[model samples]
Target chain A: MAAGGRWRQTLVGFLCLVLPLVSLWYHGRARPTPTLVERGLMRLTSPAQHAMSGVVASLSRVFTDYVWLVGVVEENRDIRRQNEVLAGLVQDREQLRKENRRLKELLRFKGERPELQTLAAQVIAKDVSPFHRVLKVALSAGADDGLERFQPVITPAGVVGHVERALGRYAEVKLAVDSDSRIATAAVGRDVKGTLVGSGDRGDFLATFETLGEAVAPGEEQRPLEAGDMLVTSGEDERYPKGLVVGHIGEGPARQSDLGWVYPVVPSVNFRTLDLVQIVTDHISTAPLDVPR
Target chain B: MSALGQSLSVILITFFLLGVESPLLQELHVSSFPPDLALVPVLWLALHVPPATGMVASLVIGLIKDGFVMGVPVGMYAEISVVTFLVARFLTSKVPIRGLSSLMITTMLLSVLASMLLALLSLLFDPAFQGHGTVLRLAGPVALVSAPFAPLVFFVLDRTDSLFARSRQRDAIFGR
Candidate 1:
């Protein structure tokens, strides 16, 4: 019995040291992929996570619906007042609609992007690490739902992240504000282009743009990038489509890096309140842009 | 309690805590930092359980957490948690920790150490991990947040242990 116990102790000790080292080595490699064990574990745990999220969401809905009903009377009165005002604006709205249709016809505008295929998904869970921020969010849809890894997630506001991993009925999205996340972006209607990387602070989903190109020549006059400058996807990497709203630039003390220039940007999407998002599944190719490489 | 019973209880508690930490506790973010409720139970297990059991419990809890949380490597939290459990176990054995104050102090130190280990490991393994600045900013608040909950966690776990003990005694006396 004593000998058996000693051997078991030795085995356990060996495993304790070996398991973590193996995991570290596997995860440390560039473009690390989840192992079979990881996938199995994800498959096993996803249902539980889904169930927990469902319960919490249900409770929140119940509480909000029942507790906040007291304001319904006042809200109804306010809605009635708003309805009266809206009635007066119906004629103006009809006129504007006619004008908008005429303008669209003149410009030969297609209703929406026919090339891009998108599917809507709901966020199920978020990262708990306060220090790391919400580097990832769990989504309700997964491989079974036509979600694929590296597919970009977005909202009406702007870019959210890409699908990092897709299991049976669940997927993990690597949020745009994660320290590891990078997106190719450019200033709208400007020559400025850079890669946006997350600034790992919580409640502050600010990203810093690492500009690409030669520095401004000494004593050469150059227009400075300013706050509220709209940013859009450059499609240089071919990951995200061009002209998708990325974010707006924020004013900060000018900083320079070997990359060229760095500026802070406020992401267009408010990550904190992300309930629903769209995943870009496929897009038809268009004519490529000429580049001076 | 039987060993199996204790292990099951620990596993159940850890799972529930994992659920709470991610989706539930995250919603109650106070001042940008939510208390790591999972760590509280981990500390309790390490301090109160036998060495082998504690180690197993720590690994199980850590792996479960890794699966649910994102951005970090799979073994990062598990490794840190195992180290924390070992250190806590060693210290408790060497020095008798009495009173709620001492326990709370120990909890704070362990929390800080765990956070630092996480930061260090990220720096070593994750190429995208920036630096120790985020860890430094969060360590104090996380430790402070976890400290107040130590006593509560300890009390609940202690009660659980006692309940199991009592039931076992009753079973033995009844000779089922």
Candidate 2:
């Protein structure tokens, strides 16, 4: 290589290494949006990336829905049995539902949760890196639609996560199963309350717990939390609504820690097939939420 | 092919791989850790291309990686990837790996190194990052899983590169 060429290469290499270091330091200082350089470069390439990811997701759907049917027969049988039982319950519930609606009409009740306004959104993209579990949601919304950043996002099944960033027509939701996610939660009927945290473990959504409220009594023999024990949002945490399902205790003995035994929580949202979610856009009052009787 | 052609080709390949890598791994039921296919292109460039070109390729690949995932700091992966590439370029220039076994070993070691660097960077950048320790614990396992994949990935990249090269070379031969 010529002297000038060698000089240019060395300078380029140095700049490449130094530039990222500078970026890391800058970002660590504060929360910021993409820099102009990053935005420009991303604009040039994002279309292609988006197209490829869409195609790949379609292919994955094929593999998941059709190619892998290992336990379909057993699953179908189990569902059929459950469906018969559910059918009976549905008939009984229909009678109760009619009576409840009639009573509500007499009382002039509008709805159970009129205070909490929400807009629906569908999952458009998922963060490809396992470490960063962010989902891109295509909102049926606009800036003036009462949607804002850091609002609680949920599905009918349970809590999906919270909106980390909200732009026009789209928002980024940080999953409840991500290591960075934290939610205030309590055991459904037990005195146990704790902060739910995701471990970001592979294969499943297994999160850890930190005891927060009243401690277990000293004298009595305490039963270790077991599998399928339910947890719900305590409403103590400002981020999510109180009483929303967070997760359930996982299939393992409660993990013992200095504070007490903390069990693994299996999040209620089926992240693998998470198709739609609702963002709780309207801010709630400071007064404790009253669950309808 | 010219320098720009090779560079553009590598960039596109990296982007596509980043998009599909996780889903493919999930389909394969390899949930323990994702095999680092991103490393393959950088490795190939390091081994085959000139140092300046390799460095540029690594930087571009790193930037793509930074853009590939959300919730991760933009420059974290970019810096780690560039550093990893520099190390690979330096080592290969010194010792010069020949066979698949050697390639596999180098890849495995580099994978571990990159993971450790990633953990360290995460710790520095994210105050709430609880997964750095977990990342450290899983580094060996991830490296072991990723090592065998290196040779196969390299083979595909090599075959693809040579296929185009052969077509170009045929024109030269016919003209000569």
Candidate 3:
């Protein structure tokens, strides 16, 4: 701690600091090969360097696999949640598209015929047993809504039925395929006319085409009521609108039976698959139907 | 301990630290510029020993580092070690060497200064040195990370220096 020793210590530190810069300047100028001391120190430490490299590399793998994978698992869970949300959104989109198409068609059809005021109803249930062909309809009632007795019901496919009774919230319909259902009919591009009567839940769906008022005119297009001929309402019965599709001819030509020609007919609308229908609320008369006896 | 014994022990401790530094930093995924761990003991020697012995030890430790380092010139680290010892000794004199906390803070400060000094010397010496950009890029984060390791390294080196001191004391007592 004497002043001379302190001065010497300070001088030694300064000289030590100066020495390497001088060596660096010389090494830069000479580009000399490493000295014996440098090579000796390298030889001394190389084994330890190699050993630490091997040991620590193994530890890094453990950290990468075990610790880092926890984050990967969390990321995967987030992706799965995103996938579920996307799937539900897609399903809702498809449902909306279908409903949009259906509503657009209904609006167009309503515009096509403005004579009758219509009311919308969802087909809640169907009585498709052998004893009956009735449909249960739930009305989407408006503020001033009311369904009358015997309102003719129709769909985009064609005439479905007529309301048998209005039960305030809903109504039961007598489907066109029931035994008591009747409509004036004529086959397309044919010289014959008849009344289409239903067969009432019969097997094989053999219905209507029972009572022809006129025959094929002297064998002109001899099998006039051929298979696939469309039968449309003639409006002669004061029941359904004219030009409404009632049914189509069955798989065969009409039989020359005693009942003029017993041509098989199938209803245009498939009641089993029907979802929504419209009741022509003011079709026949606003005075209310007699629910024909 | 004798000055020769103390310097040798510093060299021995430095060899292991320089050996472990690269692989350990790589495994720890020390981002950006890796901290210069070889500077740790230079700081210790600066604070503990006489300026002469500490500076010599610093030069030898830097020379040992020259063996492991790839791009740097042979004597550059030797100069860095000597200069770093001088700086650390100056700083600790101004503020007395206290606890591990102060040692860690000083280690961080010294690390950044040493890095800057390295860059400056490289520019003056090695014409191809472009790592002046790295010091600017890291903004001395490598120095920050180098701080935590100081306390542990300081603990180990302190114990080793004390053991040497005690062993020499027993030798003096036995009159050998």
lDDT of each residue in B1-176, candidate 2, tens digit only: 66556666777777777766644554555545677777777887777667778788888888777765566666787887788888998888787777778888889888888888888988887665667877788788778888888877777666666666766542110121
Interface RMSD score of candidate 2: 3.0
lDDT of 1 by residue, A57-82 (tens): 66765564444444556658677657
Higher-DockQ candidate of 1 and 3: 1
Estimate, for each residue in A69-163, the C-alpha lDDT of model 2 and write its tens digit.
44457759677657656764785698589757644542332144455667777676666555666776766535354456568888766788887
Q: What's the distance in Å from true for residue A159, model 3?
A: 82
Clashes of 1: 0
Supply candidate 3's per-residue lDDT for B43.
Answer: 84
TM-score, prediction 3: 0.45
Please identify which of the two predictions, 2 or 3, would achieve the higher DockQ against the true structure. 2
Q: What are the runs in model 1 whose C-alpha is more than 4 Å off?
A: A1-7, A61-111, A135-146, A215-223, A287-293, B29-31, B167-176
Q: For model 1, name the residue pairs that clash.
A: none
Model 3 lDDT per residue over A223-255, tens place:
656778888776777777666777788886666
How high a TM-score does candidate 1 get?
0.82
Error of 1 at B96 (Å): 2.8
lDDT, candidate 1, B21-52, per-residue tens:
55665454443666656676677766556666
